[model samples]
Target: MNKILIIDDDHGYRDVVSIAARKKNWEAYTSPTWRNVQHQIAEKKFSLIIADYRLRNETIIELLDYMKREKFSFQ
Candidate 1:
């Protein structure tokens, strides 16, 4: 099963992606809170990430940088 991490502050956006992933039978997890999202990512392996270009706390580039710095990889 493909594990997908969706990072978005917008509830509607998250729901839309989650519903789409569900239709494809993929396991999708949503991250509304940035802090908790980090913990979740650290604890699990996600095949892909769907993030908003702009977030309340940071931009997508910064998020990608953080993931890189942490040596997180996707398959």
Candidate 2:
């Protein structure tokens, strides 16, 4: 199963994605807290990431930076 990470501050959106990922047999992890999300990425390896265009504490740029630094590709 592929691992997918979703970073969003919306509960409803997270739940919907979680359900969809499960249906596809993908492991999904979500966080409304940006700090936690970043920390998790450092410790876990995810095949794909689905981040919201906006976040409460961190912007898309921050996420993009992490992705770039980690050499994560769209594939």
Candidate 3:
């Protein structure tokens, strides 16, 4: 099954996305903060990552740069 990661602080949004993904038979995971999210990314491979453009901890650009520096291949 396809795996997906949904990064957002909003619980409602996460729930909605998770439910949607489940309907499509995809494995869905969520992380509310960047600190915890990094471990998830390192531990698993995701087919898609849906993140909020503005996180409470960092902006999307910062997150992208961190992913690039860590060599986390999303593509």
Candidate with best TM-score: 3
On the 0 to 100 scale, the lDDT of residue 24 in model 3 is 99
Better of 1 and 3 by TM-score: 3
Locate the minimum summed-lDDT window of 10 residues in model 1: 32-41
Scored by lDDT, the top model is 3
Regions of model 3 farther than 4 Å from truth: none
| Runs off by more than 4 Å, candidate 1 | none
Residues 1-75, candidate 2: write the lDDT tens digits: 788888889999999998999899999998886567776777777888888878886787887787688775542
lDDT against true structure, model 2 = 0.81
Candidate 1 global TM-score: 0.86
Residues 1-75 of candidate 3 have per-residue lDDT tens digits of 889998899999999999999999999998886667788787778899888888897777877888888889753
- Model 3 score (lDDT): 0.85
Q: Write the per-residue lDDT of candidate 1 for residues 1-75, one digit (tens) a residue.
A: 998989899999999999999899899999865555887787788888888888887788877777888998776
Pairs with backbone N, CA or C atoms under 3 Å apart (clashes), candidate 1: none
TM-score of each: 0.86, 0.80, 0.88
- Looking at model 3, residue 50 earns an lDDT score of 88
TM-score of 3: 0.88
**Candidate 2 residue runs with Cα over 4 Å from true position:** 70-75
lDDT of 1 at 56: 86
